[model samples]
Target: MLRRVLVELRRPQTPAGLAARLGVEREVLEAMLASLERRGYAGLAYPESPTCGVSCRACSLKNLCPAAASEAPQSPPVWRLTALGEQFVESAAEGG
Candidate 1:
């Protein structure tokens, strides 16, 4: 069965969001995310974003963005599904 952690990552979100959604502690979520990253199911939207960038709220790649494209701010990392993750989730959904 697909893990709930992996399923929750179908959408990109901050670490805090993931924790809140799963109702788990941050440490547990971090471990899960690390494992997924090692297995290649998920990763940061972008390795990094422009320093003090603007909000990418409307763009599809916004999650990866470290900051909005405008000016004066930054955001936390956004975890997202990789190609393999998408395939995994899709196949899982289809199977069950």
Candidate 2:
């Protein structure tokens, strides 16, 4: 399941979108995301700046964006895999 989460996180995604994709509750998914973050497997997509560059509706990833994560999102952070996470995914793919 952790591997699956990392795989899905190849692209930026929100807690709610990820939860729905994984068939888990938002709270449960957040816990999992936290764990991955602690291990350097996942992290914020826009750590240096805010991600809301364009209006929500015009964004290509709107469906996976923080704004779409909830009815009301105050610049919710989007999650993505870190370098370590990419290594993990690569190793997993190679069955290492």
Candidate 3:
């Protein structure tokens, strides 16, 4: 399931999109995403700026950005494959 998730993440996608594509619940997908992030397999396409925090509500990118694992907003975050993740995907494609 984790590998399938990684394969789907080759392109940027919101959590909702991912969930729908994988046929899983949003909450379950979020948990998997969090696990991948912790293991350095995947991460945010655009991480929140250092200055941004709880005040995301006031930030102009509030609707454009996805919060880290700590905050599981219903709004999807754009997730991407990390370097190692990409390599893994490529290797898998080559039947490695």
lDDT of 1 by residue, 1-96 (tens): 227877887666778888999998888888888888888887766433321122356446564444324333225667667778877888888995
Residue pairs clashing, model 2? none
| Distance from true location, Cα of 93 in model 2, Å | 0.4
Q: Rank by TM-score, descending?
A: 2, 1, 3
Kindly provide the TM-score of model 2 when superposed on the true structure, using C-alpha atoms.
0.71
| Model 2: how far residue 11 lies from native, Å | 0.9
TM-score of each: 0.69, 0.71, 0.68
Residue pairs in candidate 1 whose N, alpha carbon or C atoms collide under 3 angstroms = 53-68, 54-68, 54-69, 54-70, 55-68
Q: CA lDDT, every prediction?
A: 0.66, 0.72, 0.72
User: For candidate 3, which ten residues in a row score worst on lDDT?
Assistant: 46-55
Model 3 TM-score relative to the real fold: 0.68
lDDT of 2 by residue, 1-96 (tens): 888899998777878888899999998899999999888788766423233344445655556645444443235667877778878999989998
Tens digit per residue, CA lDDT, model 3, 1-95: 99999999877578888999999999999999999988887877644432233344564445544553335433445776777787889999999
